[model samples]
Target chain A: MAAETKLFGKLKTAEQEHEDPKEQLMFDPRPREELNRMVMEMMTTTTKKFWLWAIGLGVGVVVLLFGAWGYMISTGMWVTGLRRPIFWGVFIVTFVFWIGISHAGTFVSAILRVFKAEFRRPFTRAAELMTTFGLAAGALYPLIHLGRVWVFYFMIPYPNARWLWVNFRSPLVWDLLAITTYLLSSTIYLYLPLVPDLAMARDRTTGIRHSAYKILALGWRGTEAEWFRLRKAIQIFAFAIIPVMFSVHTIVAWDFAVSQVAGWHSTIFGPYFIIGAILSGVSAVVTILYILRSTLKHMDYFLRPEHFDALGKLILVFSMAWAYFFFNDYLLGWYGGEAAVRQILTLHATGPAAWVWYLMLICNMAVPWLTLWNRKIRRTPWLMFIITLTINVGMFAERYTIVPLTLGHQRTPFDWGVYTPQPVEISIVLGTFCLFTFLYLITSRLIPMVPVWEVQEGQVAHTLRKIGKAEVPTVTELD
Target chain B: MAEVSIAEKWGLVVDQDRCTGCNACVVACSMENNVPFTGEDNVAFGRGTYWIYNKRMWEGEYPRVAPAFQPVMCQQCGSAPCEPVCPTFAAVHSEEEQINLQVYIRCIGTRYCANNCPYHARQFNFQDPDIPEPMNSYLNPDVTVRSKGVMEKCTFCVQRIVGGRQTASAEDRPLRDGEVTPACVAACPSGALVFGDLSDPNSRVSQMAQNERQYKLMDELGTKPKVTYLKGGGRNGG
Candidate 1:
């Protein structure tokens, strides 16, 4: 035993010696009842600050989002900075930005769940919530950016007096179908795993909260049959949602790709947009996780540095992948020898909006490549928050470059013009940001942000085995 | 025996050398189409609603330079880029006249069609027509006044086409060559603009379009534009 101790002591690296296995959420086991109580408390408890923020954001949504939209709808599209040559402005940019953010939830929850990544146990619900809200914010832009917002129903496939079907060939029609499919599938995916937890909340609460949870729980009893069905449903959705998630962004990419616009017409846009969406989405997950950890009650226990570390690695890989596609797009565009495309590419770097291009490259490529490689930086929650935020800012600039910037310069030099976002557009964009945060805040308080049963199930499967003098953490297959 | 006739395919020819850069055609088009005149600020901001405008280009160094004017309107392509991208069938082709049509009431104004137009011919009504006082009195009753949030463009003067066809049908005879002239063609002082039926082999536009110097703008795009331009340098005598 003495020799075994000496050998085990020598086997441990300096980094491993400092790292405690207990710091990992999986290794740190908590009783099922205690875990349930903690999640319930987190949902039920709200501070004065939370109400203040919710009210402020609510007012912002009404005045800035709906109010400005109402004014624009009554007046004209001239309220925005849209004119000829730059027909699509900040509205389309913000639309793509929100859609990119929505990609995070499905990617983290569905993709990681399918792979059975153990670290994804606690924060999958948080990420999944982002998917739904991000979509809610995003799907508004297609209607909001229209010149005739009231007539937006014309795009929907339904019987009309005119009997005119929407042109299925248009990419916008494809976008409508794809986004609708994604939103419905993602919402169902979010609710399926949530059923068991809603039942837990239903049991622990009474009054109005009990009634709400009771309806939402769908009468879950946690019996063996129910568990079997729930697991099977989750497994089926996890696989199904992955492709839906992929197609949503790919169809969005096609909106620009299928156009005859010189810079936007490219085959690389499909995979390029998907990679970009994932990069921005995963970064958003990290940003939200940091916010929840700092703001929510007991979120620190659920969302630890280990999760941040894992997500940081993902952001780094996606950043690299994003850079690859970006370079590939540039190389092909430059090599193709199209004069208009070459001019647009050159204008992007050297034009008046050159700062946006530089910002995109620096934040998306330079910052992540330089910083995320370091283990300490990746593991630091606060630092990850800032890096991920910067990456999102970079992604926004990238979309800005892709949309209005590219549209600003076309084959006709006589018509080339610059576009600036007007005050109304800026207000509307800020309002959507507020709306997303507001939705998340309200949702966090209503639903259990952490799936307690999933975490507890993870804990049941995880145990420390004594091998010689070492206690090695092992996971048994729960499935 | 009654004769069988093919549909009339309308065409236009612009003789650039004779185009004096005068704004008569533009003014006449605006008056005839009931196009709203946006103020100077809006015009300067690239929000002008002109369906036909001259693209002015300067040739040579400052000392040797001369101003050249190319009056660009809708090419009225045989196969237009702006048609299929529209979510609604707002931009469609006229079967009888063989011209592109912008259905004002049908346009939901996504502006996708405007973006797809390589010629930059299509214009959006950013706001309701602001023509005030006596200007509104002369508004053409034949044309539909487009409101804010819809696209409008040169229709090859479809109202005039319909009027001429109606007159001919009532009189019980084939429509005469040079009988149906668009406002811009009728208003051209130097006779630079010609409008006629290209399908009629004996029509003036058909003969003019056979000029060796005549070429369509951006013809490589395969849009098959019906408006042909005779090169501006007086290389071919008028």
Candidate 2:
């Protein structure tokens, strides 16, 4: 009996020395009111520097994006560097890059939510916001790429007096349909989870802010039935939007793949694009999460090191998947013995755009594989930020190589020409980045960046309990 | 009634053996179709709006070097990949003429059709055409000048085909096989280009298309281009 008592006492002591559950956000839960107050402070407490940056971004949008577009329209597409052999240049590349960035939101929010990955709880809103804004940024390019932006209404399917109809057989038409479905569905999905949080914001404010939140909140009293219905709707959206998300990028891939163009005609393009989208998307989410945690006060309490660690692991896994798809795509093209395919692959590796090709490898494959394997490095916020930022640069380079450089070379050597983007294209591309960031910054102030109710629910399901000689962590099925 | 009874499969046969690579056909087509003159600077930058251009390839080396010129233009394929990919119905096939017709006013300038064309035969007017001062007076009245943001290509001079058909109908006679001639065929100094109804089986282009040396460029791509080329030709001079 004395031996048993001593054993129990030793076990208890060992448990005390073990890793503290308090270190985890799930175990160390903050009061919902406290979390709300912290977020509110972050939004309300704006510094002079924030204003300066906001004004700068606003100027960038006005001058660079809109100004360049206006100039292009007034002058001609000649003001841009698009010419023979490379008709689709930087605009197309940026379009695909933005679409890939949008994928991060769906993968993190919808897919993780379906799988019940608890780490997604604190930063799902940040990821979801990316989907909505990134898509908006991406959708702009197709219209901008049009030589007759004024007559873009022709692409829209409407019964007209001229008896004209949009060609549904075109991949661009599929692209229009798929992207619209994704953008609308995702916006609704992003808004569904925000109603309860908006209700929370409404209760804690007054005056103009109060009225704004009041409308956004839809007069939610947080009834049991309201919560029940919200849960059901979110689940339906979560399941439905995943396929839409898949179709959007796949259709984009078809824009290239359906053509008999050498580098583009590949059976592997669908999965290749989806995996690439997730990789770029997850890296973007990780970068944004780190920025939020480092810059925003009291975010340290909600977005703990565990979240970064999980995201880092995801980045690493996706990096491997992207590398696999890339290799599968390249190997077939290299060995297929098609002369045009061989020439394109050769140009991609050793031609004028080879620098971008190599950078894509170093950034997407080398950096993540070497750094993410260490848990400590993944937990380190600044380091993870650099890693993710590198991944984004690499992914952008990959798209550029795929879109422009591949188009530069063709079956006939006579038409082969190199593409160099002019000033108008550069300005618009930079402007889109500023637009995305500006929208995100504004969104952070308007809504709670963290879902407080979800976090509290997560805390409820997680606890540490004693079992034999050890105290192990356990999670109960909350649903 | 006679024109309706005739099934026309319009095609071109380029006799490589007879071509002198003089580039007269290029100028003729450009003038007749009212193609935009983008000038030397734009041409250097790969924005030249030539509807039919010479694709010159140099073979051998040093003293034995030989230059071969192939007059490449819109192939007007039987199974066009560009037709299905145009978001607007700008690129469509004319069953009566057996030719690909590019509707300038309908083209929204997506450029998807241009990208899909393996031959790189399609051209886009990136800017509103400028005929300069003196060249403006020489513009063809029959063909509409293409505007910026619209794709235009060799239509086998559809205006001429229409005019010839009208004349034949007015005269109440069967249209002669050789009555319709594209500007390129008329301008060919070496009599290398033949244009006629391939469906007649007795037309000159049909007989030339059956020659042992006759082959379509990128035939294995299954585009089934109507323009046939007779192999083996060289010009000692550029």
Candidate 3:
């Protein structure tokens, strides 16, 4: 027995550290009750730093966004750097960029959910919230971009006193309809799935917070019939929202495509925009996931390296898709040899804005392809975050290039002019960014960031199965 | 609101050969239409709100340089790109007069029409324009002074067309051949611009439009502008 003990000690010393499969989120499951408590604790607990950051962001929104916009309203659009030829400047750019960012949430929450992507379970709400906030920020720009924000209702299709009506032929009108539809649908999409979780919070909490959750929960008792209806409704939303998501970006693409602008008037813009949306969306999700994991307590367990690795692969795929569509657009234009198109392409490639174009290529195409091809890099949270962050910057630069750069190019060389955002434009753009972040920060605390029910559902379906000498993670059809 | 049928397809012929680039027509249109005076700072940024302006280009080296000018205004295209893209239909194509109209009150100022305009003819009032002291007294009562954030372009002087049409209608006769000469055409010192009904083939503008040298700017784009330019320095005499 003494010899056996000594031998066991020697074996323990020599044992190789094999990573257990249970370390993965799916393999290592915690009870839903524990997850709810963890999320509630994180939500309820606020450090001084949190309040300071929120207040600072709130001040920024008030001063930069609302204050500047009010000033612009009274002072005039001249305060913006929107001159002739570059009539649509940073406001349009911000509008498009936020729309692109908004695309990420619907894409993940609806598309991934439709496909039954298991890694999507924990982060769908994070993505959906982005859709809501990004769109809220996006919707502001058209109003802000309007020369008279007061008469913004004129864009509404209803007949006016003079019997004048909005032109449905205009892509801008289509953009309005599509974006409004998306905003409404996505908000409902966001809130519908959140009902059960709110109910859980209602039962577990007390006082004002409990009452708030109870009202929000809509009497969700999680009964068999309720669960059945919730699943069916979510399924319907998952299917219906996918096309709406596609249409929203496609309609936005039409805003440019319908125009005769050499760079913008391309048939490929629809799909090209969709591909770009997914790339930016996935990048945003990864970045948000990284932040949640690092900052929130117990989030490390919910968001594992496995999730990062999966998202990295998805981002890589989308990056390749973006490159493909981009090339397709280029090849068609190049082959057609349209003089205006050639001139614009030359300008984009080698002009003063060439740096932006190159950065877009590197960030959206080069970085994702090069680094994401490595499994280790994909699994690294911080590295993936940096990559995604770079992608977002690249996407923003892409929108800027599309709007202002292309607007600079017209058939009349004599009238050709460039745009640079003035202080008002810059301030408003910064304000919108701060506003989106501020709303998101406050929301992340209110709603369960990790969809506990969805996560629990996923955990029920996922199991370990023997494959040869190893135990591999397998997912059964839960529904 | 009754169907007001119009026989005249009004058109313009710019004889570039006769145009010396005096920019008087620009001033005339601005005055006639009550276009606000944009400051020099706005002009430097290319935000000048001139309805009709000379598009000048310099050719050859400094010693041998010659300045060329082409007065560009709203093309009044039959298939106007700007007309269909306006979200508010503010930039509407008037089928009755065959002119492009800018309804200031209807304008929400999305600037989509301005961007769609290949000629860059449209000008947005970036700020409340001030006609310097005493000049405001001469502002045309017939024309509505545009507010800030509204886009204004050469309307082919729609007020003149309305007045001419009213006079013709009262007299119970078809409109005269050159009943409505826009401010720019009337003000041209060199007789470079001609305006008339294209439906009347005998009209001077129609004959000039058929000249071998006559060409439409960006014709390949299919905007099919009603205004035609008689090419200068060609074998065919203007």
Each candidate: what lDDT?
A: 0.90, 0.88, 0.86
Select the stronger candidate by DockQ from 2 and 3.
3
TM-score of each: 0.95, 0.95, 0.95
Candidate 2: tens digits of C-alpha lDDT, residues A80-129: 88888788999999999999999999999999999988789988989999
The number of the candidate with the highest lDDT is: 1
Interface RMSD measured for model 1 = 0.8
Pick by lDDT: 2 or 3, better one: 2
Q: For candidate 2, lDDT tens digit of each residue in B79-145?
A: 9988988998889999888889999888888888888888888998889998678888999999998
Q: Candidate 3 DockQ category?
A: high
Summing lDDT over every window of 10 consecutive residues in candidate 3 chain A, give the lowest-scoring window. A5-14
Q: Rank the candidate models, highest lDDT first.
A: 1, 2, 3
Candidate 2 segments exceeding 4 Å error = A1-19, A465-477, B1-6, B233-238
CAPRI tier of model 1: medium
